[model samples]
Target chain A: QCSLDSVVNKRIQEALKEYKPSIPTKTLSCVSITSSGRLSSCPAGMVVTGCACGYACGSWDVRGTTTCHCQCSVIDWTTARCCHLA
Target chain B: QCSLDSVVNKRIQEALKEYKPSIPTKTLSCVSITSSGRLSSCPAGMVVTGCACGYACGSWDVRGTTTCHCQCSVIDWTTARCCHLA
Candidate 1:
């Protein structure tokens, strides 16, 4: 049963791979979910900016550093996503 | 003086604009610092993922939704950058 499940999962993953391209093109940053039900790691030369948080992150002052920072709500930064500076 | 600051700010912004291309094109999501030293907003189709935080945000299960989420350390999520799922 486990083997069958693994095969099924692999097939599903393969299908997903075919369905999607390695990201559109010239994409600076992108997001992806994983089997563990979480966001996947970033691609090359990219980093994950945890824009969201459990508490309210008033504002981020990452100026003079790189491209920019993410936008977080005044409420808990629960919806924190990622950004890429391409 | 404030007026001069505004003018200088505008000139600096224009210079920065020329120095940078509107995100180098095809950006799914990105970050930018503001005059006040805060992150700018996301682009049209994409949203900001606050993957970082002052507290620890374990793996975010955004698998069902769109592509994925950001990455945060077990630490205080300080270095939480951004991701663009391109």
Candidate 2:
């Protein structure tokens, strides 16, 4: 019984040493709108709306000027934005 | 004034047609533990703990078997898992 208790104690210690909380390293990037009233190309992780370039590029919104929204839904790459419409 | 009203109506119509809600395409991956009491490699955009493989590989947790948590933090690539420890 004493030996079993010792083994259990060792296992508990090992478990304590081995346990680690999961922390996510990757972060999502934010979307941006361009000044020319056009949507811009988003970086790899980001999606472009209303912008005329990059992934998921298309007309997203129109007002006095074309307003576009670029967003990154992924976690690895940082988001980016650029304009193409004139 | 009548011309202004027609132009305004046309603009409203265009605005209605142009509006699109922002939708994210990328999704985050889930974490998992391996059968060998070790952590498996997580695909891109995922964080792994316990199982020992791939990026950010290390011990994440242990029980009857070693279990690792793998997740994808980025958006471009789908998450993957593999075991390295025996």
Candidate 3:
């Protein structure tokens, strides 16, 4: 008689070895922008700005040479506003 | 005299409006392959086979014309093995 348990175990192992997982073909990237131009990171909670911007409760202030006490929430920080020198 | 509060508030609003968030430039895609050929969704916890395959305690058996009792955890289901006709 064929051992059902052994047969199943063998099949399971074979299937596991012959399996191949997929990965995202395309990459997922995002950008961040400030009032001036572009920035590295943004304040916590606050999004990049514009795209889905908001103010974070705790985070470093955007770098720039402006006394403007404002925050931006952008979608892509790559092309987001950075700073202005007026 | 300029009110610090008003100045800050005005700047904040302007910055908020002109803000924009960043998104993943590249798409993150994955493929899934089965012992047979390809399949749709797989069991939970168990990834697709090969790439990062595994078995789930609860889930429908992959569709196919085979009695192979095995599970796969694939990354992308687009090209994951489906079933066999033996």
Worst 10 residues of 3 chain A by lDDT: A50-59
What is candidate 3's TM-score against the reference?
0.23
TM-score of chain A of each: 0.23, 0.30, 0.35
lDDT of 3 by residue, A1-86 (tens): 24644554555555446544333343223334444322444333222211112232111122222111222333223222221111
**Proportion of true contacts reproduced by candidate 2:** 0.00
Estimate the TM-score of every prediction. 0.23, 0.22, 0.23
What is the per-residue lDDT of model 3 for residues B1-86, given as tens digits with 9 covering 90 to 100?
A: 24644554455455545545443443112223333322344433323321112222112253333221333343222222211111
Clashes of each: 31, 27, 85
Provide the RMSD of all predictions against the true structure, rounded to 1 decimal.
26.2, 28.7, 31.1
What's the lDDT for all of these models?
A: 0.38, 0.33, 0.30
Stretches > 4 Å off in candidate 2: A1-18, A25-28, A33-39, A48-86, B1-86
Q: Quality of candidate 1's docking, in CAPRI categories?
A: incorrect
Worst 10-residue lDDT window for candidate 2 chain B reads B77-86
Q: Which stretches of candidate 3 lie over 4 Å from their true place?
A: A1-86, B25-28, B34-86
Global Cα lDDT for candidate 2:
0.33
Q: Which residue ranges in model 1 land beyond 4 Å of their true spot?
A: A1-24, A32-44, A47-50, A63-80, A84-86, B1-86
TM-score for chain B of all predictions:
0.23, 0.27, 0.36
